[model samples]
Target: MALLFEYLPLILFFVVYKAVDIFWATGVLIIAAIVQLVYYKVSTGKIETRHWIFAGIAVVLGGMTLAFHDEQFIQWKVSIIYALLGLSILFGKLLFKTNLVEKALMGLFSSVQKEQEVEINIPNAIFNQLLVLWVFLFLSIAVLNLYVAFNYSLDTWVNFKVFGLMGITFIAIVFTMFKVYKFLPEEQ
Candidate 1:
């Protein structure tokens, strides 16, 4: 449910794009992003930093696309978002000695562990490796987005944005799970 909420804007954008066109879809994307932020604020009492950053990018780039009557601005949004995310992770680890990826993953699993009465202990070394993998993954996706946006049709780029990126992220998650499986306690 939370995962779906995170993706609501992208899902709506793809649907609206298929029904109408890029302009209408971009408008929908911007509105949906704002609505998602509002919903998070109202429900959680505090919106996450990533949500704020993503919504800001959506509004700025999506507004440019609508105002200028050019899809290039909207197309560039994906790459920009991914690039910033990758850089944040890289800098957070290198300069600040903080691992954002480790924090996020541990927070997620910790919640599940509390609910299921299970202890999942993934080593800090594994998380450090995972963080590096995630940084590379995000940067690669950013580069891939630019390549597809420039070399492919708008429809193709939209499909790649909605599906290809999601697929790649899913694969990465699966790979991470495999890497961490050895740490899980065996069931009797």
Candidate 2:
């Protein structure tokens, strides 16, 4: 599925974190991002600046992790990415004239019935909140990983990574849907 590639870094990280070293996982993430960049450029004929920035940061941070020989560096990767994304969304709302998340997600944030009208503030608020949520989620995951890694086997962490994150995400999706449905315009 298309989502496979979209989340390939995560998949590679989870699998390789157990089987291989963190350095190998970092390499795979960098390589995948590189391949994706060229693929998107060639196929879509336009490069997303955001992706390029993210890939570049990952490469630099990954290289640091390998160079300094510290696994903690690799773990900070998600935290930094989450913070950056949260800041970006905030930036879009406060500084930029456009809503970055809304522009990027296009119609994904809008309801089926509201083809009639979308209040810009609503999308902006939702996206800003989502960004903040990501920050908290990533930080919590990082802390949980630390606690689990120190206390138990890596296998437990891996299992938690897959099932726990997925469960939380599913719950968030359901909550968002409930909110959207509640706010949808009534049928005429």
Candidate 3:
């Protein structure tokens, strides 16, 4: 549900882009982001930090795209959001002594374990490694987005943004799941 919500705007953007033009897609994306944010607030009773970050980028950058009738600002939105995610994880680890990846993963892990009546603990060293891996991944995604945006046509970049980027991310998550499986307790 949350995952669907997270990608709702991008999915809508792709649909609108294919149906109409970049300007219309940008406008729809902005609206989708706002609707997603509002849905989150109503459903969860509060907005997550990432939600705010995404919505802010969408509105500001998409607004610029709409106002100026240039698509470049909206094109930069993905790279900026990815960089911000990487930086926020880095800052949280360095300044707050909190590993956001570990924090989020552990919460999900604990819930699953509770349901299965199993327990598995990941060492801090491994969590640190995971955090570093995520930071690098985020930064790499940002760089990749920028490279595609600059070197390719808008239509090509939009395709890369929706399909190519999603393929990379899906592969990344699958790889991470394999790594995580190593630490799971075997069922008796």
Name the top lDDT candidate. Answer: 1
Q: Return the TM-score for each candidate structure.
A: 0.94, 0.68, 0.93
The residue pairs found clashing in candidate 2 are none
Misplaced by over 4 Å in model 3 are none
> Each prediction's Cα lDDT score?
0.93, 0.65, 0.89
- Model 1, position 129, has a per-residue lDDT of 95
Estimate candidate 3's alpha-carbon lDDT, on a 0 to 1 scale. Answer: 0.89
lDDT head-to-head 1 vs 2, winner = 1
Per-residue lDDT tens digits for candidate 2, residues 43-109, read 8998788678767877887878789976556555555665566666666667775565445544664
lDDT of 1 by residue, 58-165 (tens): 999999999999999999999999999899999999999999988887786786677778888888999999999999999999999999999999999999999999
- Report the Cα lDDT for candidate 2: 0.65
Worst lDDT run of 10 residues, candidate 2, spans: 112-121
Q: Per-residue lDDT for 125 in model 2?
A: 66
The positional error of residue 170 in candidate 3, measured at the CA in angstroms, is 1.4
